[model samples]
Target chain A: MIFIVLFCFISFPEQRNINELKGTISMIEHERNDIEIMLDNVGMVYDSADGKEVTALTSVTMDIHKGEFISLLGPSGCGKTTLLRIIADLIHPTSGNVLIGGVSPKDARLKRRYGMVFQSATLYDWRTVIKNIELPLEITHCPKKERHERAMKMLDLVGLSDFADHYPRQLSGGMQQRVGIARALALQPEILLMDEPFSALDEFTREKLHVDLLKIWRKTNKTIIFVTHNIQESVFLSDRICVLSPHPGRLSAIIDVDLPRPRTMDIKDTPEFTALVSKVRNSFEGV
Target chain B: MKKLKKLLTSKFFITIVWVVMLIAVWELFAFHVENIKRTPENVQPHLSGIVDSLTSDRKINGSQTALQMVIENAKATLTRAGIGYIIGIASGFLLALFMSLSKIVEKTSFPYLMLIQLIPILGMAPIINAITGDIAKSRIIIAAILTFYPVATNTLAGFKSVQREKHELMYSYAANKFQIYTKTMIPACIPYFFTGLKISAPMAITASILVDTLQGGIGLGCLLSQSLKGAMTRYVFWDIVFFSAVIGILSFYIMGIIEIMMCPYRRTGKR
Candidate 1:
């Protein structure tokens, strides 16, 4: 009872320091300017085998700006993925509210305004790459002619057009993930909710995908909420990074990236980027 | 052209060689062993004469005709096995789907189904015959019992073993439950279902033959039983030979069709 009350009291932005309260105000104001998504005291608790509640997210409150690249950076068990899922409406939160463009997550999902990419590639084993990419369009009732055209375009954007007819088994892990990204992008939603999309790839592939993802984001100005464990990845790509701490998951800090737009691979090795990585790492180390 | 050339492959050649060699040895031994045998003093004489008649130049009005008899019985046995096998496989797959999709139906019926498979068909054959009053019905009942098991077991397993991540992926796509089953679960289980088909095909035919023997039918088992009952040893000997050849040919073709159907995906790496 004591821990639950403590978690609830500290979860709201008003209970934090003046500087953090200012940061939270600016964040909400920034989101209101573009009107993307709003979460008011959102909390989630999963049903456990023994009838206990496993609190995944505790009173998470924030607003995500339209077309802003946001990264939810947290340590393991910090409920970063759970927060993203709440926004996506994959699992409903136990209490509080989630508003996507002034509607519920399920409403946003039904309107086809949301798209997601998981930690693993999650490509259908039976589908050829082209069919996999076309799946979302088919479900959304896009005509066959437009579906094929749209799928091919997404594949070309991901540089996988040549292998579109090949099955998932024929592709490497990195290639499979590229296909997964293409499939998610095929719907061309306003918001992209990614739960550690590049976490599975090796350092080389991941780094390459980071550069590729930025290029795609620049061309198509969609709001991206990426959940990741890597500090450097969060700082390099995000316009803002929301840091989280565990054990009744609450906000620690939200860092603004004043880094220049159209960030490149070269920016990843710079001193400023290095400093941000260290800062995020220090936050986790403190927790 | 490719298939014809492929028939000369080693498996076909080896099987042909095995059949020819075994038959030649039987012929030679039957003729050479006219002396006393441990089981029956007249056994060798009877066996030798049977082989002699089967291999001998035809007497137009002879007591039996090998080609006509083999073909006729093969046709009858093949028809019964094929129909019963289809009935069993189709219903079994449907039952498995019911078991997987409805928790209430599964809990209430699946334990009893598993129990049904445990009691051998031999124990129930008399009752089955009494109910149907047809030898072929008894044969169908046994084939149905044997054919149903592998389909039920494999299909249940196939539907239950979907990868958790794959299910999540489908759900993420906003796929309804029916779409998820069609898109992932059914396709994933195809290889296992085909494996069941290959195993059950032979079992279905063999069960029918056994059923015929027990129930006294006009099928090849009757010829076998009659030859044995009257001690017409030559007749019994030819009947056994005919039964073996028909079974070998029939089993080969059934499995051949299943293999052809599944050949394109034999190398599909699902993992």
Candidate 2:
């Protein structure tokens, strides 16, 4: 009887491990199949101020996975911003469609699934830091108590809780952009759409924000679509860099970043990081 | 010693010095004019004589002193100007708000505004008096008309100057039109509206004075004209002129204070 009891305890432990492994495998499978955003041959054409038709983007097809950190990398006039805006439903593409979480981009936006950060901080000069973070919640009719709590939480996450009452003008450029990030994250949306959010900052601030952003991604697990003209920045921050070329802007290549996770500023000096950045630069040259 | 040196170099000290020099020059010029042209004290009174006129208890109409009469007339003019200023601000702001709600409205009505502005508003004082036939009513209407143009143009420009990004930010939040106006458009326009107010303030007072002079009413303008026509003492004329200048300066500063109060964000540092 004692032998039987011992054997049952040992076998039960092994059975639980197998079941846990199976659960994780299924979870991984489910996550792989769950495409957060899918763009199908999306194109945009608009009339310029001079009355000429400008084809800003053409035949852009891509799929963004759940919790993926993807960068839309390009130089000026690359329609990278156009693509980001298209996903945010700020501008409707003239051709094809985009499905965000299996719904239309418009529907997704209406459902408040997209949190956007512009190139500038875009913090309303009138509102305090905490109030700026609360703006999204206020629009959504969140309860007053909940809004305050959420804003405080987001401010803490951005490491700027001390500046809760400070105005945008009082903050440095990087700090203002961090407030912008906190404002975006206050809504706890499914995807973060950043349009060169840190491009305006100095290199040191930008590098520091990169690590901080990676830490944030690890914590929140939200899919982020970052747009930038900086090649090294794209290589440093993204799991995948989607290179775009201008002159009737179109997606040229999507390169996978195979660097290790939990990357620091130190990783930026690695040969692998350098090689990937150059490879992206060469992709633009090839275009 | 260092503090004294700093005070000597200060803007306030410089302004005081310039003012004293101008006053001495004026007194010297008046003495020279008296010697050359035999101008009487009433024609070119010295600053001290003006001060005496300012303080004299001599009554005009055997009831009130010249100074008291000037104050009374000023009160009447300022009250009428204040009411007209309020009316102008409300109408101008409402019109601009209505126009901003639609591009069609703005495009259609904006040309009319330009035409109205083109017509010399002061030249219409007689026509306004003819239509109203009441002195007070005509004065008020003229003041309102004069105050309207600056407020309207500045307000419309304010609305237009709201950046595209700000509108987009509101749109991203799915904010309704009312929300957009209250949250973004209105706050952005406050500074600009104050600018209009600063300009219109002096115009409102001037309008009141002009209309008073034209319509034969009890106001500083009436006193000014009466003095100019030699019906009142020459001291009273100079006193009325001084009061009008004071009123203009006072109204402008008052508007500036209200602007600072309303838009605290425009203030750079801690209050």
Candidate 3:
């Protein structure tokens, strides 16, 4: 009886360990399957004012993962913004499919799964900073108390809690954009879609915001699909840079940025960061 | 000293300075006309005479004092103008809103709106009078017609002035048409709406007074026309002119005040 008991006790942990190993392997497989947004051969064609068909995007296929910071990097007219808009369901793709978490982009938008930030702050001048942050919540018919609480939390997250009552015009351009970011974050969406949000800022403000954004990204762990024409910005901020080229805008390359975590403005001076930036710039040659 | 400097630079104080300078110029001009041109007192009557005409208890039309007559007529004209101004602005804004919503509506109606503006107010007045067949109603209608163009055009322009990116931002939230207008378009168009009001305000007052003058009615315009016929009543004419100027200035400033109240974001003074 004593020998049998000892053997059972000894084998219990070993069996458990093997089971735990299997569980982790399955978890890894689940993570691999967890594509947050899937754009499969998506295309956008606009009918120009002169009645000519303009192809904005051609055969763009990409998969954005959960909690990953990805950038759609390209120059103007590369359809990067158009792609972002398609993902936000602001504009429909002329061909192919876009799935957001196993559902159509339209359905995901209807479910409020996306929080979008534009190049300009786009804050309504009539609404104060806090009220602007509260806009999406208001549209969703969130209770007044919860709406206020969530807006304040978002304001705190962007470090603009003190500017709650200030009007958008009263704040500097950078501050206004921060308020814009807070407004987007207030939605608590599954993904954040930014369309060249920092392109307008001065270089100094831009670098500062980069650090702040990475911190926010780490803290929130939300998947971000940033659209930018800037190479350095994409290299500094994104986990993956999806390089695009214009003239029937199509994906040219996808460069993985393996920069160390908690990256700062200091990384831009590092050779690794410079190499990544050059790689993105060089990827444009495939046009 | 700082308070004094601030007060001197204030808008009200600046307006006062302008008034004083203008009066001095008027006094000089009056003196020149009286002494150098050798004109009679009734022609370009002196400021003192205009003041006397304002305060005098002499009965006008045998029922009202000069001051009392001016007040009654001014009140009647301003009231008609005010009502018509309000109506015109409301309808203009509504039309503009509709025009903005549909390109078809805009294309069809906008040209006629321009045509309405091209028709001289004098030609349009009699047509309105013929249609209404009542003096008071025609006066209101004429005022409204004159006031409509600027509000409609300016507000329409305001609606069109909304940026494409702003529209996309609203769509990103899955906002409906009504929400986009109420939350974004209407509030943004406010400054432009006020600009329309500022322009249309004087036109409304002018239209009301012109209808009265042309059609012959119991308002300041009629009083001026009657006074113009008799040289003895020229002082009263000058007084009416003074009162008309006051009404126009008052309405303009009142619109400005309303604009300030409505658009608090426009106050960039602190920065």
Please give, for residues A246-280, the per-residue lDDT of candidate 1 as tens digits. 88776678888888877888897789988888887
Model 2 misplaced regions, further than 4 Å: A1-32, A49-51, A285-287, B1-11, B37-43, B268-271
DockQ of each: 0.29, 0.18, 0.33
Q: What is the C-alpha lDDT of each candidate?
A: 0.77, 0.86, 0.87
The candidate maximizing DockQ is 3
Model 3 reproduces what portion of true contacts?
A: 0.53
Please state the i-RMS of candidate 2. 2.9
Q: How much is the lDDT of residue B126 in candidate 2?
A: 79
Model 3 chain B: lowest-lDDT 10 consecutive positions: B36-45
Candidate 3 clash pair list: none
**DockQ of candidate 1, scored on C-alphas against the true complex (2 decimals):** 0.29
Residue B221 error, candidate 1, Å: 3.6
Per residue, candidate 1 scores C-alpha lDDT tens digits across B1-271 of 8886787676978799888897788656655664435534235444445555556555322654654454466577767877888888898888888888898978897778877678777777778888888778767767877778788778888888787767755665677778777777777777667666767787887666666668554565555565556634444446455566567567757666765565443445554
Q: Write the per-residue lDDT of candidate 3 for residues A83-169, one digit (tens) a residue.
A: 998998888999987878877888888888888888899888878899999988887778999999999999999999998998888
Worst 10 residues of 2 chain A by lDDT: A22-31
Q: What is the C-alpha RMSD of each candidate to the true structure, in Å?
A: 8.5, 10.3, 9.5
Per-residue lDDT of A226 in model 3: 95
Place model 1 in a CAPRI quality band. acceptable
True contacts kept of each: 0.24, 0.24, 0.53
